[model samples]
Target chain A: MTETQGLHIAVVGATGAVGQQMISTLEQRNLPIKKIIFLSSARSAGTKLTFKGEEIEVQEAKPESFEGIDIALFSAGGSVSKELAPEAVKRGAIVVDNTSAFRMDENVPLVVPEVNEADLKQHNGIIANPNCSTIQMVVALEPIRETYGLSKIVVSTYQAVSGAGAAAINELKEQARDLLDDKEIEPKILPVKGDEKHYQIAFNVIPQIDKFQDNGYTFEEMKMINETKKIMHMNDLPVAATCVRLPVVTGHSESVYIEVEKEGVSAHQIKDLMKTAPGVVLEDEPKQQIYPTPASSVGKNDVFVGRIRKDLDEDRGFHLWVVSDNLLKGAAWNSVQIAESLLKLGLVTVK
Target chain B: MTETQGLHIAVVGATGAVGQQMISTLEQRNLPIKKIIFLSSARSAGTKLTFKGEEIEVQEAKPESFEGIDIALFSAGGSVSKELAPEAVKRGAIVVDNTSAFRMDENVPLVVPEVNEADLKQHNGIIANPNCSTIQMVVALEPIRETYGLSKIVVSTYQAVSGAGAAAINELKEQARDLLDDKEIEPKILPVKGDEKHYQIAFNVIPQIDKFQDNGYTFEEMKMINETKKIMHMNDLPVAATCVRLPVVTGHSESVYIEVEKEGVSAHQIKDLMKTAPGVVLEDEPKQQIYPTPASSVGKNDVFVGRIRKDLDEDRGFHLWVVSDNLLKGAAWNSVQIAESLLKLGLVTVK
Candidate 1:
């Protein structure tokens, strides 16, 4: 290939929030792309998006849209991925699916690049991007898990409304205005839009993110639990998650309680380990009153961690506060990073 | 003394946030107070606030402000309470301090009436209100602690900007607007105003609420840790807190991981117990997509509990998602409740 003769790239669901970020991430990273195909539903087919100073008209994504595409990034709904991902792969594209569609499939490789990029080699023609919360988490913890044998993890998240979609972010803004104006506020798009009930997100938190499974854990929480095990290569890693939606627009913060196999480990030691870990930013300085905040983390790709302290009772337990821009490190950036990895490792050849 | 006689009252630092709430709370609850003496700093003297539709002028608070006052509610800064609580006490007014100035004092009684009302009998003229997070957590967990037997608690808080003060709330709003408008966002009045630097609370979760102590716990986290024990009357109870500020304006939500002293209790059993708990509303049905949201709990006084689940690995451990309006149950209503307890228990009488 010539110096700038790049791979042909296609982005499924290019009109959505995460899909837009995926397109931007690809542009910002400059991952050797020669041609770009933007796909959305038929309703959004004529939508125009500018990347690298060129206005690209989005096309209606059908199975035929994947023809000659070297790499396809699918971020439509899960159902869309369920139908379109295989078609893209069959048409000679290596698909990086961003939906929950291929995530739990035993054959599809789930990649964080920083955590489990090697899993990409095992991809059955399609790769899975883990949930936003799980992707940021395992990125921070996997390094520590390798150095210090792991036991258990319990995490409660402070997530931004943007994770739900642009509509939810708009809803939070609308409701906050109504709340402050002493006007009646109503809910239309939170907890789960498909679920029967909805709650306002303004000045509040909703505990349920995705719908609840039979196990009582919301689908969002179970995604964290199962996805963490898969990404960390530890199905028996004793993980628990409480996923919550806050009024933030981007970024996700997590209070993680961890039990390592090693005993008598001080919080400072773990923090030091995180300081050197890849894709992690350690901001734990108690004396100067330094720590991470989601607002400060917006648009940043690194996972910011602080508030590390040993558990008061459990000698083997430790606690950490993890924060990151959910759209960046959690989704779009992770996908871009995986594409970079695929290129760097010479795992994919342009047809 | 006749039962219908109005009771004399003093409102210390009446111009502040919680103090303003105290005034409105009394009006809302229709407490029959004979008089309200509005006291504040010398700078705030001559200000007027309407109470019960009457224009009450604030006067500079001095040692004599408590003279002939029956019940004094203080929400001034801690220094004011430190210099003036005893002065108010010596002048015969019963002081309900909303500052940490007197909390944890061996001679003073820290009371959350629902959790430990009888302790009011030992009060030496000062009843300390618990921290906002602690008050809400104890309100939700105290009943569970009583029925299930308490052992350990791990809480992660999604706090409101109002908890920092009215100025912080304004800062959060303005910063959000600036971010949306692509203007330069200034950071002030957040992550501890007294610290050397400030961070924006818009679209952010700052882990540090107060200045960090030597112990690495932000004063806010330490407050949740320490106040929870004193309120629940369990000094040895293992409690850890990760206090974070979201862009919220009023309510706070906590993800509480608790280990019960008893074993083999299902999540359903705990949900059943909390559904009937006093001062609590259980909104924990996952099937119908019903769960507590912070926006829904804003104007209410009761703590809302939901997202109850037993930890998959630890039969003794369970998770609870608790939410309450910090300005209400966490502060104003809680303070007002203490005053009502004093009046009902015949602990306060006009001179």
Candidate 2:
């Protein structure tokens, strides 16, 4: 690709939920793409998607698919990313993997552009996107951490079914319809899709997001705990998360309690800092009843912050309500943003 | 009334959500009610409800209505309780008020039967029921607090719509139907119905519950904070809460993080303690996927506790998942239990 002709961009799992979002985000963003390749598994390979007002046919993903690709956005399962990300990297493509395959890898950089874009410089051809829940939270917390210096975080998430995948979203809708119609539903997806017992998500909350680990915390909770520290480069920061899946379809909301290093910092100072923070929108207005809700934050790229309050007793603690479109800022937009960061940082050059 | 005969019980606001539950709970319990009188506001009066196979007509609640009542349960709003509870007390009736009107009153004992039943002895003919969310949480925590001693509590609630009243429940269902039918809905009763703006609770989560106080905490949150401290009888216990309304119809779930005074207490020990704790049911089994969900906890009188886990960083900190039917254990059942406590304590004797 010539410098003026833009770069070759390939989207893996293009027919999937986050994959489709990646295509749309790429179309909407100012990413320079001369060629767009949509790749999916054999089952979804023949599907067609619209991007930039043009229909693009998805092809079966293969090692040769990345030969001429400058950047590959992967949203398939971890196994697919684990198998293909290395191949894409070897083929001269800088991959922004949106899976857990390499998120905690010592060699890979878990990038949330607003929080740790500088860490992208250490990426070894593959940049891992943080979990959707973690992405919105870190984006909202980064400014506070920078201004006040962070020490501890306790988060309880009200996550959407879309984060589980397109199938889980379908299950939520189907179960809801069945429940409304007074029919029985066999829940096959949610909390953990492949877990032994599937629980209904319609009008209910599941405390477990992913499978439980040996330590009793779900994998999703560990991801938030481990990824937040990794992305912020704070190895000793105390973080605890209770990851829960709600009946919502897209956006994720979190009630975060953070203890700052400074003792006298007020909630107003934190709100003021978040007002101009990168990719952050402040929507807190109690009397006017203005605050971020999942329905209101859908399709938005910015993380919405509201309900900021100082802890009633803890001098150093403050509470926040953070919301964002999980598919956008949490997944697709963050992946696309990482691609933009790669271009801005000159980590990837046009072939 | 004869000495062998049961006492006369009155249920104020009997046509409302919690009031209806109170009538049902009174019927289910072994409380000796020689006569059942259902009372509501003029708007809902004259409605007929069945109790123990007999239809009881709801009458307009007035000060004279409590003249023959030996025990009166009040769950109408705070204003109604403020107006009628004193009248009931003056009429020689023990008022088990389920509103916030007298909960913080110095003279009225705020009692969660399992947590602070002894405080009922200090009641000046009026006993206040703790907030629904606070009632369930305190029940689950009281056992642990008694065994391990609690120092601080941080809770995030996933509350049901019924806590707002029957109108909010109707709004949730209608909004769900409208959303499923691809129609627009005007939200009029959620996240504080009387507040300036309303939000869609169907397929969404609202961060605020009750009106925002001057100190920035929502009244529902402050209720949890203050009531927990008051019911637990720990004046200086640092408690914080973020109460949110979800689409669930009946059950309220809470994610509670607590620091115990004693160190090295495992989560298993806490779960063991809760197993035999009165009005507390332990449902934690990570390997078996056994945990208390709102849907499963609906219509149940017990506060279900699950997902008990020790904090990874703080040996003294533990996280618990507590769920209960907001109307049952949170309101009606707690009020009924207080009446039972009154009978058992010989505070209310047959005349």
Candidate 3:
């Protein structure tokens, strides 16, 4: 391919929720894609999805599927990414992986374009996407961290069921219907699909997300804790997360309490920073009763932040309510943004 | 009335949600009640509610309604309590008010029986029940505070709509039904009914609980912060809260992080502390996928404590998940337990 030609792209797990979003985001974004292919597991193979009004048939993902593909986005599952991400990398395709398989790998660069676009230069053909909860949070906090160094972060997430996947979404809807009908609900896919003990996600909040780690923090919480440190390039930064799944379908909301290194930073100053911050929309107007809710944040690409206030006791501490479409800014849009960043920063050349 | 005979009891706002639970809790508890009267606003005065299998008509609460009453439990709105509580006190009745009106009054004791039962003895005539979210967290944390002094607390709540009122609960049910039917929902009561804007709470979470205070903290958040300090008698303790309303009907769950004054404390030690803590149930077996969820905590009087773990970075900091029925342990049962404490301590006289 010449330098003037559009890059060839492939979307793994194209039939899944974030995969479909990747395709749609790629179609909407100004990324130069010469050709696009959709791939999934054998189970989901033969599925048809639309891209820019064109129906694309999903084929079973294999090593050869990466041939002639310049960029590939993987979101099927961790096992699928672990099995095929290297194959795509071997075929000269840069893979933006949306699983936890290689996030902590020393060689991989976990990129949230707005936060660490420069880190894309360190990618070894495979770029890792941070956890959905971690991506939006870093996007909101990066500007603050740059303006005034960040000291500590404690976040409690009100996450959506969609993060668990399409089956989990279906379970949530079905359970809601059954619950409203006053019928018995047998939860099959929630908290974690592969883990034991599925809890009802309709009309209830489950404190467990992903599987519990030996340290009592769930894998999801650990991801948020670890990913933030890595993506922000601050390994010693104190970060803690309590990830809980809410009944919401799309957006993930976070109640973030942060301590900045600088003293006497007013909430108004932080609000001003968020207003001019990249990819962050300031929705904080308490008197007007205007704040971002998960329902209002659906299908949005930008992270919504509001409820910015200084901690009552600690002058260096501040509280913010950050929200974004979990499937978009958290997953698909983030991966696609990485691809766009690669092109924008000349990290990947077409020639 | 004599001490040998049962004491006269009156329940104000008997037609409301917490009032109804108060009646039921009174029936089940060992508190001696020789006479019981139900009272409400004039509009709900004639509503008939069953207590101890006997139908009691709610009368319009007036100064004369508390005549000869020894103990009066009030769950009416703040305005009603401010207007009638002193009247009840004048008639020789001690008031356990489940409203925000008297909670911050320095002269009135804000009692969470598990944490501050002894404070009941200091009540001049009116006692205040703590906010639903505050009551549950303090119950789970008081043991730790007693064992190792607490220095700081930060809590993010997954609160139920029932904390708003019976109308908010109905709104949640109706919105769920409407949303399940793919119908549009216009939320009228949620976050706060008196608040200007109403957001959908069916599949959504509202970060603002009550009205937003001038300091950018919601009234509910302020109540949790202030009331926790008052109940624990830690006037200078640093407490912060982000109170969010969930779609759940009854139970309120909190993600609480606290820093104890003493160091070298392990999560296991805290878990052990919770196992025997008064009004706290330890469900911290992560391997068994057992934790306190809003669904599992329904109808229970105790605060369900689990996911108790030390912060990964802060040696003095520990995290906990606490859940309890907002109507039972959070409001009605707490008020009744305070009355029982008053009786047990002989703070109230039947002579």
The C-alpha TM-scores of every prediction are: 0.94, 0.98, 0.98
lDDT of candidate 2 over B1-351, digit per residue (tens): 112589999999998889888988887788877887999999988899998988888999999999989999998998999898889889989999999998898888999888888898898988999899999999889888898899989999999999988889889888988898899999888887778888899999999899998888899999999988888889999999999999888899999999999989998898889889999888988988989999999989999999999998888989999999999999999999999999999988865
The CAPRI-style docking tier of model 2 reads high
What does candidate 3's lDDT look like per residue over A252-316, in tens digits?
Answer: 99999999999999999999999999999999999988899999999999999999999999999
Poorly placed runs, candidate 1 (over 4 Å): A1-6, A50-55, A176-186, B1-6, B30-32, B349-351
lDDT of 1 by residue, A174-231 (tens): 8776666678977998877888888877766788888899988988999999999988
Clashing pairs in 2: none
- Per-model RMSD to reference: 2.4, 1.4, 1.7
lDDT of each: 0.85, 0.91, 0.91
Query: In candidate 2 chain A, what residue range of length 10 has the lowest lDDT sum?
Result: A1-10
For every model in order, the fraction of real contacts preserved is: 0.70, 0.69, 0.84
What order do candidates take by TM-score, descending?
2, 3, 1
Tens-digit lDDT string for candidate 2 (A56-97): 889999998999899999999899999999999999999999
| Segments in model 3 whose C-alpha atoms lie over 4 Å from true places | A1-4, B1-4
Model 2 error, position A242 (Å): 0.4
| lDDT computed for candidate 3 | 0.91
